[model samples]
Target chain A: MTGRVIVITSGKGGVGKTTTSANIGTALAKAGYKVVLIDTDLGLRNLDLLLGLENRIVYTIVDVIEERCKLKQALVKDKKNPNLSLLAAAQTRDKTAVNAEQLKSICDTLKEENDFVLVDCPAGIEQGFQNAVAGASEAIVVTTPEMSAIRDADRIIGLLEAKEEITSYKLLLNRVRPSLIKSNEMMSVDDVVEILSCPLVGIIPEDTGIITSTNKGEPIVNDEAALAGKAYRNVAQRILGEEVPFLDLDEPKGFMAKIKNAFAKLKAKV
Target chain B: MEKGFVENGFIIDLSDAKNTTQLVFELSSVMEHPEVKRKNVCLKLGALDLKQSQLLSIKALIESMDANLAFIDTDSEQTEASAVSLGIIVSEISDNLEPSIVCSAAEEVKDEEVVIKTECEVVEEDKTVEVHADLNSNANPIETAEGIEDIYDEQSTQELSEIIPAEHFEANFEALAESEGLIKAEEASKYILLDTGDVLPEGAEENDTNTETLPTLYINQTLRSGQTVSYEGNILIIGDAHPGSEIVAGGDITVWGILGGIAHAGSLGNVTSKVRALKLNAIQLRIAGLYARRNDTLNVPYVQKTNEFTPEEAQIEDGKIVIYKKLRRD
Candidate 1:
């Protein structure tokens, strides 16, 4: 099965790229597609941990590309989803360990077996950025509703266009808060879509579950009850050519939904 | 083609498999349209290939449909071959046949010494008017001809159409009235000069040494940490806008490289001033006194650290500057 190689990138670091990749990969795998999440951050790899497969990573992407191990040997299967896998980056290495061509070949190899290969790109448009994009046939720019993240996302989109890698790019607006958007304290998804000129792929709401999930080395998609988990599943469906509606960030809070949401939140907090 | 005709423009190839057949049809349809086919459309078709006949057919179809078909660049050998086969002259012609004809009127007068290509009346009708300035010198001659027919007075060179038609030219007179283009009128000796080749005056300044005085700020290299450049007029950055770098301009700000810094444009409270960049990602942007941070909330600590290094523009609206993506498509 020819898998679509998608690079999840944000020019600025720590804008939830790994989180987005892990969740989306898990979500897609849960949808029954054979998915592989390749962490291209190299030295600072966190996707394995985010997907709760860190301990299972016996071989890294560096090992696979460097011929120390085969691609299958380097792939760490997610315990939660038998179909999902993680090709962890070498934490001992830096962004320079790999290049775009190597990543492209790696992704090409994986494409023959997997339905989707998600390259979790390192933040910053540097060597690592080039390597991550090298293998990607499509790109998903992950950014928050903040001005800086949007700007960096824009810069990444520009570089992607300049490299002529992908004809069109998609934007994944993560960590958006409905209350903040309603209060005009934060940029709305509309505002971002207007400036970036890219179609909105997914809008992940601000959920503390993502943080807790990260701390626990489990992607939010593993938790079926979490809002973020459901959102990631929606994203996965959208990527699979399903016309799923975006998670309602602007929907007014109903008493029952709010109460259930609050109880869910309180239970998680406790 | 006259000066500025397809200068630095590319050729669009109509034969690409990746492009939708509908798009190719639309382009052909656009060429078939009488108005757009007359305009100088640059082509950059990359590796798309088409047979010579198909290209000629498209070109002729476009030329015949437009009133001003002077943009045809049939000089190249390949195009010349097609033009010969199509029975079309391989010369640059004005899109507006009228101005080209008027311009040619002067050329014919100047070239009186040489054998006239055709009778004056037929030349007038067929755009065969060629003028010669020097009668005695049999040396290289200046040729000016108009391909547009019936758009100008053949007898008197009073262009029936305004040099810049008042209807179409909503002159940026407010800003450029003092420019040489407007002042050239006053510098000329007469309010009206026919195709006699009376030289127009170099109004304002003949040399135009005022380029240095245009209130431009030149940034030598990429903007790095904590550096800021604020100007009342335009700001041109020769390098990248690195993270933590700040640039605030009352007018437009043009960044030549990756703009990964904070840029606040139209800071002088002008809504029209634009902030343009090759790559825009700003950490903090402020247009005028309005301010916006990369991420407004402290929820995501690690993301905030990266946000401080992102670049983008912050424009003022309703007394607040807000960060936005550099490319506003709608």
Candidate 2:
């Protein structure tokens, strides 16, 4: 079956683009789809590290493009999920080594064998970002609620529109703090969506479990107890054309606990 | 060569015409047709290789017969230019040529009607008005200075000489000013006013004196952050100007929606220009040489409260950009 190539990009750095790509790839693989994740960050390759497949990467995307190795030989298979594999970026090479046409040809060949190919894009609207988005038919922009991140996301969306190959795009609001949003201190999901004006793929709340999972080089989606893990699974299901309701971040535990907490606060006020 | 009769014209194809004599013979055959002579039918010349002089002679022959003619299917630019130089209207060289000529002729008729209506009104107001056939021509000499006495009897002249309304005169003056590019239109009022001191209407002098209407650029979508729009003229946005988006205009800026970005209106140092917005939450604003940042302590006038937000306008006051509510004009 032919796979759909999707790129996960955030114009601003440190906004969980790699994490979102890793988790979505893993979640799709867990759902029994053959998925391949390519880290197009070039010198700053980090998708393999996020997937815990860093040790297995003997060859990289540059090796395939430069004819140093076969495309299959460069793919590093994940330890946990046999269906999930990664084509890591070359840590020594720069972004200019691979052009859009080369990556597009590689993605075309990879789509013949895998069900999904997710490219983890590099930050900034530079050569690296162009290389990452060159092969994808769809884009998922990751951004935080901050002004700077939203501004960069806007610019990236404009660039993506200019890239005629990417026909559809969605936004993934990462690291959302529902408490701060409720207190009117931070931008809400609606505010971010209104400004960005893109369809929402998923909203992953600010979870500490994401940090622990990153330390272990394991995507948080593997943990059933993690809220962010569940969110990524929901995103994967949505990508599979399933209508999954968004997770209510304010009541992460249970609806009963949320009501009881509200009563307690009202009692204290009285 | 093929000669055929079509509706309202005859199509004489001179694709095989090898000499100027053959070309003239083909044009003469089409012009001599009874259908073409009975009415002022358009003779469409097709694929002719005639020289400029030959074409001009053929056009003169067609006009001598009182039949309208046009070079309708010419591929040569030289032929088209020759026809235009000879004052012969060249219909578009396309498959459906008749409708294009008809459409342009209809437009000319409409323009002439407007000119006639304006001239008629001017004549009725003042019999001294001299009507020019071509309003766009710069050489509009007065045809006659004979007053209302020449056109009407004494009784009718008295009725027609009743005071012309000021509004109609102003419209006529504006039209004249636009065509003449004169500053006299603004001064025309001072000469017409009785010596009694009455304040001129608020916007009347302003419109006349400001002859150069500033160009305006319109943005109908939200300007997101990181997007900077710099215009050499005034800017009008129908959507929100989000934070981090910068708009620099050389003239006044008007935002129909919320303005939260950095706006520099009148950037070329025109201090009288202002920036108006429905909600002025701008991070920084500059009008001309004056600058203003969003401050919590500055108390400005005319802050109107809406349902949820307060709409504010900013203008240069006392050499600084000050935020105020939009004053109701009425």
> Which candidate's DockQ is highest?
1
TM-score of 2: 0.44
Off by over 4 Å in 2: A252-259, A262-270, B1-330
lDDT for each candidate structure? 0.60, 0.68
What lDDT tens digits, residue by residue, belong to model 2 across residues A1-270?
Answer: 889999999899999999999999999999999999999988776776577654345458998998867899788788789999999987656789999889989999999999999999999998888888888999999999999999999999999999989999999999999999989999999999999999999999999999888766789999999999999999999999999999988763778987898998899999
Q: After superposing candidate 1, which stretches have Cα over 4 Å from the reference? A: A252-270, B1-330
| Chain B TM-score, structure 2 | 0.33
- Cα shift from native, residue B32, model 1 (Å): 86
Q: Of the candidates shown, which would achieve the greatest lDDT relative to the real structure?
A: 2
Query: Which residue pairs show collisions in model 2?
Result: B302-B325
Q: What's the lDDT for candidate 2?
A: 0.68
Candidate 1 lDDT by residue in tens digits, A44-149: 6677656655434445788887887678877777766889888888765678778778888989999999999998988888788888888788989998988898
- Docking quality of model 1: it rates as incorrect
User: What tens-digit string does per-residue lDDT give for candidate 1 at B1-330?
Assistant: 111112212122232334335435655654543334445343322233334675565555554655233322432466556546665443333223244444354465543322223333434455332222121133122233223223222423433212222221112222222221221112122111112121111231112121123255656566764467877666777667765456876555667566655566555554544454545444444443333333312112121222122223333334333334322111
